[model samples]
Target: MNIGGRALLNGIMFQSENYTVKARYDKEGNIFITEEQTPTILDNKFVSFMSSLPFLRGIVALFRILWSVRKIFIISFILVIPFTLLLQNYKVINDSNINELTIGVQYLYIVLIIIIFWGINRKYGKFHGAEHKVINTFKRYGKVELASAIKTTRISSRCGTNLVFIVVVLKLISLISGVNSPLVNLSIWLVAYEIFELQETKLAFLSKPFITIGEFLQKLLTTSEPTVYELKPAVEGINHLIKLERTNN
Candidate 1:
């Protein structure tokens, strides 16, 4: 069976061909990267309760995204300092803030995000590469071996890097159009995902421009070619899950 994995804080996570492993990490570094042998009411009931309060649940979800990025203190600093500068420069110095579209805030945000990513990528891109290689090799083959997995390219169509870009685009569009709504956000994500899937399959030439943007995001901000040692965590994660599945059976 194929093995697939994703990178997470302090480690990477993998799944055997039979199951799903989500990237949901909690405080204390606990994660939903593995499946329990049995389900519980707490899981079902809590999900139902959370679903009933969409807005509150959405806030919690936003916290989860923020918490994931809290590791990058420098990025956080870059984000805050620039916004403050934008406010200062674009301000009336009296009563109101800039209410219209301007390159100052939006461009600064994109630039800062890229700058932070450039630094992070150089240091940790190898692990990111390994995560992709392992998953790609497993999805095409059936297992992961360090020697073989190392041969795969780090680029992935379903990368979180692409998702990051999607969310950024969605937010910017929502801001500019003044159409901020959960339903709109969901629709944008779904549409973006479908476009990406099309590029992977039938609409290759038509989606080249969009795919190029994502590729740049991956190349500059998301990944680098991995070394064998960098692949260890991914290999181990895949093997660990496979071992559990064998025992469970």
Candidate 2:
């Protein structure tokens, strides 16, 4: 069974084809686990049809992920607006340099997002590391126990961080080339997803540059070496997911 997951503020979430599980720690230091049916937009015929196509499938997948985290995107947008208005007041963002301003705003928005995740939500990187390690352990050894997962790498080739890196590079290229249209941005995501998937194929060597930068970024900012205590929820969530998948099979 293929598995994907995300790190939560105080824990981890793992999703399989049919089930989603979240294992978290409460303020009282107790561990709690919750399971639910996995949600998908593929139930809609139109979305399912699009997901069967090539480049469009990548776009659909991207949309699904973004929708799952819509609240974070909404909050980030709201926070950036005030900063944008403040920049406008200072005449730092003017019509004559709108493209450059857009690029600057995008960078600032990323900074704000990192600050939000790292500052307000403490231990986020540790949980993120734990999530990756558990997934890696499952893929490598078909095990999700803490002992096995704790020894695995925290960086995954399939990570969204790599996609983010590709998108950022594409966006910069578009801006520099004076082509900042919405369609261009969508195409960038399509191409980025293609490259992201290529990393798992025989042509993976071609993506070494992107992978190198992504791994560096993951190590530097996105993930921290988590303690065994921090890894508990991730292991529990993935183990539960594996059991659910096996039962269904």
Best by lDDT: 2
TM-score of each: 0.60, 0.84
Give candidates' CA RMSD values in order. Answer: 7.6, 3.2
Please list all clashing residue pairs in model 1, or write none if there are none.
none
Total clashes, candidate 2?
0
Worst window of 10 by summed lDDT in candidate 1: 34-43
Pairs that clash in candidate 2: none
Which 10-residue window in model 2 sums to the lowest lDDT? Answer: 114-123
The segments of candidate 2 whose C-alpha lies over 4 angstroms from its true place after superposition are 40-49, 74-100, 110-122
**Roughly what TM-score does model 1 have, to 2 decimal places?**
0.60
